[model samples]
Target: MLRKFSSLILIILFFTTNLFAQEKPEVQIGGALRFNYNLSSWKEGQKTRGGDFGYDVFRVNAKAKYKGVKLNAEYRLYSEGFGGGMLKQGWVGYDFSPENNLQIGLTQVPFGITQYNSHNWFFGINYYVGLEDDHDMGIKYTHNDENWMYAIAFFKNAEELRFGSASDVSDSRYSYDVSSSADGLYRNKEVNQVNLKVARKFASGNSKHMLGVSAQYGGLYNLDTEKTGDSYAIAAHYELNAGNFNLKVQATKYKMNPENPADQDSEGLAMTAYGAPYLVASEATTYTIGPAYSVPVEWGPISNLQFYNDFGYMNKANDMYEDSFMNTTGVLVTAGNVYTYVDLAQGKDHPWVGPAWTNGLAAGTPDAEWETRFNINIGYYF
Candidate 1:
């Protein structure tokens, strides 16, 4: 499959260049270096030590255009604790017209929200569960116009850095992908996924609105059983932009039914991203709400400030599984060639929030307490 896909790209490029190579290709290169400081309420020792401040990541972005053909790629390097360097996204596309285009390679999945579902740097709960801003190696077709937008995609699986059936699954990915658990109890891989997304745009006075729905269906291949099962997600979302205020509202429901051995628990499956692995609930309903407002200001290098509050809630279908929640209130500061995110985020049954280790996203500990983290991420972009 990989070889065939590669060949297809070459063939298209060759034919297109021969048919329309009248203009020179244009190229651009840029990137960023970022660092973070965090003080967590759950990390008592770290608080005693005056919080943790460290290098976050450095990334490079490259893009090129040759008539209707376009390419964009980004490579990132993170501290070893996060994950080693890896490709965030790389894709080749052709613009059929102003309203239509097709992309192939590692690209973002057209899911619940188009670009991002959260206003803060720390995305909503959906991201951790593989429902938001998730990308895979696939082909996607998109159409856009004044009144509507639509997209459909088919992905063979997540990035093929390593075979999923192997005992060790790669966690150096931008988004969560189904994989083996640390204990190796649940081992499943995503396959044959299909996604459909549509949105309607309208405006009235100073307000603009986008209302959309998304559906996704995919197969889950369990290594222990060597049989394929299925998973599906459906969502309804709305976005509003009025003057300097923006709001996002979404409701999503998802489920996974994977074929597993008798000894393994079928209630949940393992998934990983960012150098870590954990269990995800087999069935759940999620909701997200966010509101943001931007104010223009001129203070030294600062030009604007955006204040936002994003919230997410996950309700597990099984009573034995505890629900999960996350909320972030913050401001984004934009300066000349620099951006910073100042946020106070709180979570219940969330791994990143901490008191409980890897169990926050799965069955969840009954004694889980709400935890908070105050963070600031600064980046220089060029």
Candidate 2:
């Protein structure tokens, strides 16, 4: 299947470029192929079965630029059962100048951290709550200089997979978001969101640092009430690099209020991802810290190794809910276009960490014990 698709794409590209009558912009196509191995503490049966190893993802990325206009897009294919395939991102942008730019379409939201808030495959608790590495249908403006970087965006909402489906729940995309499901766990939809992020980049001797603050607010449109509620989050973050060592820290507070119908609960939300939905506390405070060091290596086929430990914690504003925690100790090996990550990840009250697929981010189960997963992911990028 893949070979046929690749050949067809190449054949089309060959003809499309030749058919152009005028000078063309630069176009680049690239992608990555990856696989993963996993063993979990919670899955006693899996241990008896010698763990699971399988295909991960094959993705394509495309970029082009013509004068001041640019485009970027990515599409991904995964294994048969889980998160089969989706459009990760697609955006069009115009560079007003070297220091200013604008983007429209499905682009990353300008909130919390710019690209990522975690160094591991399993991201921080904030990610489960829809604050990190999130993309939406929006327009954004950005400014950058030697000492300052700033961006603001107005998102209509998360990218919709279906326009008029009878069911509102959808987990067919890349990022996690709160929406109503067939189970009727939630009824609020994200809409009219705005985000602001500002940062200062500076250096002190051999150390480089970045300090930033981010905030976002939006309407939570209730499907049942036909009335709009609201949600908001504020965050502060800092990063430091001294020689080969790096440090990252972030703190965030968020709240959600939905005009839920009388029968529904307003203190909780259902966040969807990976073809499933789970509950999350509507109000919480989250914190994450990560530190990493690099070691240059002369080993065969290996250029460098990065050792890191990341820790994240979430404290729910509702006293009835349990706190959530996650920690990852990992090493990344980089060899040219090949990269590998070996991680020992532990979590308490995390949905991904357990065998039961419980909604740990919301009310949480009683006596929630820690669960662990040993994971290795290898990818080759071109």
TM-score of each: 0.94, 0.92
Please identify model 2 stretches exceeding 4 Å from their true place. 1-23, 165-167
lDDT of 2 by residue, 180-201 (tens): 7647757767899999999999
lDDT of 1 by residue, 30-94 (tens): 99999999999988898999899999999999999987789989999997767778888999999
All candidates: CA RMSD in angstroms? 7.1, 9.4
Tell me the lDDT of candidate 1: 0.91
Displacement of residue 237 (Cα, Å) in model 1 is 0.2
Ten-residue stretch with the least lDDT total in model 2: 164-173
Q: What is the lDDT of residue 204 in candidate 1?
A: 100
Worst 10 residues of 1 by lDDT: 160-169
